[model samples]
Target: MLMFSEDKGKVKFNKPLYGMTGKYTLAEGISLPYFSSLLDIDRAINELRIAEQVPASLEAKWSLKELFQREIDEKRVRQDIVKGYLLDPKKLKFFNAITIVLMPKGADDKILDSFENDSTIPPPTIPWEGNDVEDGQWNHPNARIANFGGVQFISIGLSARLRWDENRVLAVAVDGQHRLSALRTFREDQEFGRSGSLRTHEQETKIPVLFVLLHPDAGFLNVSVQANYSIRRISRELFTDLNKNAKTVDKARELILDDKSINAQCVRTLLTESTTEDIPGLLPLSLVRWQDDFNRFDTSYYLNSLVHLNLLVSEILELKDKELRDPMDKKQVMGFIKSINDALGINGQEVKDGERPLTRYYLEDCCEDEEDPHTPFSRLPEHYLDSAVEGFIVNFRPWLLRLLLDFKPYQELLAYARQYNLIEGNFGKFQAQTSKHKNAILQQENTKDSEWNKREILIPQSAINSMKENQWAFKAIFQKAMIRLGRIIGFEVRSENKNLGNIDDFLNFLNGLYDKGILRVDASLPDHSYRLWTFIALNPGNEKIKVNRAVEDRIFSLLRLWYFGTRKIQIDTAAGEQILSNRKLLQFFAADKNRVHWPGCPEAYETLRKGFDVATLYRKDSNEITIEEKKELVRVRFSAVLAAGLPVLSQLQRGALHEQSSEYYNQDNES
Candidate 1:
């Protein structure tokens, strides 16, 4: 086995990158443990032709039968959607082969040198709302993909440290990259102006990242990493020299079935190992990590970090007192982390296997790199999280889950491998992306790690729109608002009654308060007006005055509804789980400290005075909300800045205002 110290540096690889550890075909003077450098990554990649072509030349020319098979396969492929136009027997000669003319020296030399200093080549993403383009270059003129990350241009680069024994050449920008060709087409177009922007120029506006070659190769070489124009996964020879140093998911694994606890008989009884409470002793479990079998490399530095999490858990739980048994505090640690999601809240997310109280869709991002044998998550102490009762982690579960869980509403994440699969399932090219990975998900950790680690986060088109519309603002404003409100409402309100159905019911309760004499002030109007009252309370212009009847009904109703009927989610995190009341979050805005008469026109409150006079319904049909109404609601949901001031409107408030025109009725009718 290649020891840690001798491995040079990290070289990424797809699972099972090369054959076995020792199996590799290096033509002529090709070396093993070749290190990559700034000047060599691209060179090493293009050099594969020498290793492969030289070996292929020695093989006898294809026999008649072999040639016939190749002909048939080509014919069959020619009729498919991807190649029907190219494989027509007429184009076959021109299809598999490309004519190459040596560019008289100095061609593109300037462009090549410019890229040398800038290794990070952020190629243009296809804008979803691609506008018009000339010659079909910038905007994906070909309606092939759905969005950015779908473009098929290959990224040939190197990992350079010590060039001789630790070099790596990666041919990436594959699969998911081409999926967004459609979107990249529009965003890169300088012509995509406001005059007629597709969806008003909502996508990223970046210059198309054209590939540059500083050291240009003149001979015709096959381009084979995922591309619409290339033969998929078909290289005449496997990448051997490049594969030896690549690392894929590779780790130890054990099925920890200790019926006798016999395997652990030697464990020290004096250990009082709290970390292994559920296991009762150090448990035997399969340890796995993604291997670079596809390109070929591995590592142990990843393994050390994993062990640290276990040690941390053990140290925290090793208190001498018997009462402090399990490190339940781990839950507290977990809670401190945020949900890794940028989409809507995870209310409907489900689990395929056992149930974890908080198996959120956002948490799915944490295990994205499970494909890499050395993927950080694959090494996490998950076995500890395996059982329902007090169980020690398997190894590296917590650290990985915590890292992802810490970034709530995914901060425009880049890709991680395992997540790419889940994401593909929802959108993009999910068909077959998973490829029987579930059973393999846990079983082949060492096999899939490299692919999992390379994925970057694909930001949602909708979120990009929000940022664009808000001048680069994010929805985190709501999160801060939620946090602020959650802290101020005493977290729990006391009520004499329960059974409130929803926010609407809470509003009705406040209305009920006004019907009874318990609420003072403007009792001239009947039914609670919780929406209007709360707005008045929170509105900066409206200060805390004596309890007015207009607000009394709503306040009483809100108190009754939240104190007794409100339900809360038990947010589980590494810091442990806590039952949080959302009602408290609403109260912060309505608190007395916020009531004032400074920010806006106080005249807005006088709109309520018209309610007593305008109590009669002039038009009864205007109040109805239909399916069409709901459709419009959906589009406006993200843009609708939760209007809560006297001028603002909540869903409940809108529903209530739509019911009866309080402004039309006359006060004399009741007396």
Candidate 2:
């Protein structure tokens, strides 16, 4: 039996355990003695139990059990471990320690009968064997107890061998439950040859473990002592200390910290170099809420958050289809990256570092099988990344920035803020104060009635009210829809198409509608039934804009039809026939057949009615046309319509910016 004791000889344990003993000082007067060891795979899987399986009495006291450990994610166990680490066990390595709390078996267990029956069971004592020992009563041969200025210290020369009875104790893992679950799953899978079978030698793999004892008078230890705190209380404190402080990286932080993704690299460059002389960034650092996951309704000071911006960058680079967790098709991804580089005017020869092609910029074999390659810019030459970032700034960034800035509400908000001096140079500081202002209003207590409540009011009430009034314009979904519209109309600023004529006309028309309150999220409007925004964007039930892909797509299609009709784009006979017979557009326009009214201007409705007449003519002789022919005909008509509108759409004048110079603020003196 192995034995261990504290330096002052206040606490001791005697059991058959194979590990080194140490004490972790939690506070000035409180410390927990721990046993660190490497347990064989089989032993750890069998011996250790999760906190939920502990005896009812012990479980009841540990009210923090749910908070202490998370439910084991079975998907993580199967995919990340069984399919990842265990796929090759010979080179397996797990550096993290599996932390477990040791509790003595309850009174019901027969294993603890000896300790319970005997009121004074003698603690197992081991004699020191070294000649250097004076009393030969030390826990270790090379141990020495000394006093340094009234403080006692004990030293075990190299390592302290500790022992613990495995059967008489209950072991519960407080941390690394996922890893433990993975181990258990791997072992079970090995027995059935499910996930690559492990050989006999591989099955004996050992993992690091840390066993902690919360109380000195633990029943199985057969020792009696008094302490200020119970085992359950200490266990709860330890669990909270471990988990509460360990922060999980949110989406915004992940994007900021990412060094591999080309999309992330571009986003970071834009945010950091917002005021670069050569190509001024459209997305100012101050306006971006990079720390937030989603834009809060109450906090409308920022333009957009990191998550949406990253997605936009991906869409611009044609990398939106691939997710970070999805398996990499290296060859396909490399080809796509090469195309993006070519379009950006990066000939791969511009940047030095062996003067390689765009495809050769990144490492050929930087990742393992089944792992995501992330982006072609990952592990690329630093000079090439710089060139790539520059290319995006010059070619792609301007168009996207223009598209976002062209939104009437964004323009008006910026102008209003500038005119009123609501925001100075530093956007981050202003955003922080805005958050404080929101909090003060929410908490409604503790905040004094002095300038403490008004000191951070950088954004005036007028700007806030304006933002709240046009809330739909600042929505992530709305911006995403705009980007999609830009792509559809071939206005995605590229090297070849520098002129944003077509996109400008479309925005002006949309903004005109916005100015007339057609896009307002109010179901009580007199023209609610006839409003195009109602059918396309706003949810009638909630009187709020529906923020989903389906709604976004419908918005694009309906807008495209309106734009084409307004521009009077001509279509071929066959294609025109198919467009008129388009049941999707027909159903959308005539949602309530009882009231035969179109949503747009009378001129546009007349144009649509004339087109519907063509469908009537085609329907009389429609028996001859097949379904496939009809689909192809409709696609041809849509393409022709977009092409015909392009020239005239670009020639249309850009819309003038509108301004609202109204200031309204009310303060409450109630405290």
Q: CA lDDT, every prediction?
A: 0.23, 0.50
User: What TM-score against the true fold does each predicted structure earn?
Assistant: 0.18, 0.49
Lowest summed lDDT window (length 10), candidate 2: 662-671
lDDT of 2 by residue, 577-643 (tens): 4332222332233333412222232323233333322332234367787644443343333323322
Off by over 4 Å in 2: 1-247, 272-282, 296-299, 320-391, 425-430, 433-452, 455-462, 488-529, 540-543, 561-671
lDDT of 2: 0.50
Task: State the lDDT at 246 in candidate 1.
Answer: 43
Candidate 2, pairs of clashing residues: 16-164, 17-163, 17-164
- For model 1, residues 1-671, the per-residue Cα lDDT tens digits are 11122212432121111111111124433212211112121222222121112223222332212211121232222222112322223332211111110111112211010112112323223221234233123233333211111112211123111111112221222111221222222233343332323342332222211111111111112333212321111221222212343443231101111211111211122122222121212221111111221211012111111222222223322313233232233332233222211011133232112454323322443333422111112111222122311222212222223221222222222122123332233222221135575345434543656443223212342332332231101122222222222222211111221221323333333333323422332221223333223232222234223234444333323333232322211112223745322222222222334223111111221222222222121212435655344323321221121122111123343444333322222211111
